[model samples]
Target: MQGFHVLVAGVEPTARQSVPQAFRVSEVVALDAAGLHLLREGDGEPRATGLAPLPCLALFATPKTLPLMREARAWIAAQAAAPVPDVVLLDRKSPPAFVERTLLENLAAANAALAGSALRQARRVARLRAEVEMLGAVRAGLDRFVGETGLAQLKRVFSTATPDFETQIELVHGAPLRQVLPVAGTGFAAIDLACTGGKRRGSFVARLTLLEDGEVLAEWRVPTPAQDGWVRLGLPVAHAGLLRTLCLVVEPASEKSPCANLALGAHQPLPAAQLGDARTGLPIAPHSLAFRLYAAVPGTTPPHSADTLMPVAARKAKPVPYALQALPAEDLARVAETDPGTGGPNLLFVADVAAILCRPGAGGRIRAACPAGARGLMASVGVHADTPSAAVGVLGVDAGAAEPALQRVPVSSGGVEEVSLLFPEPLREARDILLSAEAVDGAAEGAWVVFRDLRIYT
Candidate 1:
């Protein structure tokens, strides 16, 4: 979502200096990637090394400079890549309330199985089932929360950029602006929320491999070939912002994946943020609650309990909790509240503020309409490189950064109280992570949270 360029007509860069730098969540802006002064490669005589329209176009997280560029050395073929830029700013910061469920508590059941020695393996299987059920419950619950909670509206801001982050920061630091197509990360938070607190500038990147004779050519860290291969995109923290969640719209390449390595690296590093507080001088908030959730296995098949998936133990799910520890209270409340209706504080645009933007007597610089449930906003776009389907471009960038302002968010999420999941977005996804809670001192097993008038002003 960061380092974006606004295209006026998909073919030229605009002359306007004060353009929409970034956009709010789901706010579809346009791109103007035409007339971009393409940097030439070589000496005076217009060195024509028989360049073939780049043969392909792909995008990278980093411009393949410095440590990343160096690590990508050896022409060992495309492995993968973040650049140095304005840190992502975590606008809505919130801490997490780790909770557990029945299936997870059954973690103890694995103990008896383990003690039986002969039943150790048996217990392992049972534990795994418990864990599986734990996560399934969490996913279902989270889905429900998002649908029922009003906070889902806040999602419009999720994975979006502010006008400032774009022009003032990104325009000078990362890429150009356009009015055609735009892109962003998936959600917020990371696996290590408990420690560093997820916050980072988002970037669009992919892994690549060069081949000479089907033998891997000049492995350049670029985008999916406008030709072949299964490409994977990644986002790293160029700057700092409390990352709450990250979810790729992942409009897959026209074709499907080929089981194994069709192209990109393991999808593990895609658009993910850094762990621990390396930049910020603060420690991850000591969350009063923390939990882990995982994707459920198909066929209702279960997994081994404390036997192995112990990672959910933090030592295992350690990374996840650390990530959660970095969010804010409002966001945390949204996640912890049992009431799905509590997802968002009934969001309302400050009328006075809205009126100014929509002033019939003023310029059309800003629109007062909040585009939701539509095709999303699609304004001016600058596509340095565009794809017919998804956002994929092969970029060969220069060194140095544009130092854009940041609004970082974590790249991790945890499970609801009882349910479990492989939550990755730090705080943003809290409201969506599935969790199971204990019966309130003899209360019912169901739990929920609620929100009030969420009014936005100037």
Candidate 2:
């Protein structure tokens, strides 16, 4: 046997899913994904019935968690080898084993063809009209060739695999798993997947890697005749939000088994950076932003609010102004302890293109609109989300001063983007207050703080 057909067994208590199942040391082991299936002796061999003998692997599980940790060891006592692999390869079952046959048979044929025509000088091309084609054992044994290049050339030698082998692998690996916290996780729990497969379909391969930024990169290759599902893979890519998209690629491979792992080694977090158009010292047009406001003065600011509004139609190009403003210490008038700014007195949350949307008013107090409809007036920070992970911003407003109240300006389209300091019914003065915008948050760095379009009612 190439590898042991592993299984696990166990039972759920009458009430709780947590709290180990009552009694016994050998109740669960092998043949199940979650260590919850019951395998029994039917017709002389083990057969699963979801009742008596739950089947599952004892994967470093607490002996308290496994009723069968010891007995299951006794059961598999004969075939015992190295109990654990440096890496465990997990797979869902294939249909009637036909899918496995298809994959292996293709591999066999591919190997058979390679011994003859692949080394030929003619560079002959052949088409794989068969969907269940195998690309078995691409290359090894050649001392001069590295594993990847030989495989790539082998794919080229085959000539007829359609969207190409590497591409196909990428396609399969990219089947979107449910999003996870991206940077760190141990198993599927890092994602939003159910413990049991929901009507589980087809077979796929999973490969894991780690980036410098502590993100666990799970690259999966899923092959099927037709695509209809995306099992969630748990990973979150910092501010780079499409992290799940990066890890999972869905592709159409005829057979069910993976010939080789689509090992995408050492993925790095997309470095958040600034893009200057040259010549101008002012930050470039930012993709998004995140900014924060620190309330300098201590008073009943009544929880200030701060959210961004996308103004329509920017003003015509204006000449860039010169010389950085001196640290306006007076500007810190209403503020308390201020953290030394990063992103060069701009970006927040680190290394990302961002800027500060500082609105310093009345004693250095910054009233920012909070996220999730964070009502009331308070200090706040958030993204200038034209896209995810692309920005940062900070607002500086006055809490002690009674001037800038909350405002609900209506968009021309009739929806409200919620501008601040426009409440308390004194409509005229709210609009007249000297409102200044600037780049302070590191993430929203380089955004052109131009006067853009606005059509507000309240």
Candidate 1 local lDDT, residue 194? 10
Query: Per-residue lDDT tens digits of candidate 1, residues 54-165?
Result: 1111111122222332222211123212121111111112111111122122224434433676577788999999999998788555433432332222211222211121
Tens digits of per-residue lDDT, candidate 2, 413-434, equal: 1121324332333232222212
Instruction: Supply the TM-score for candidate 1.
Output: 0.19
* Minimal lDDT window, size 10, model 1: 355-364
Residue 25 lDDT (model 2)? 25
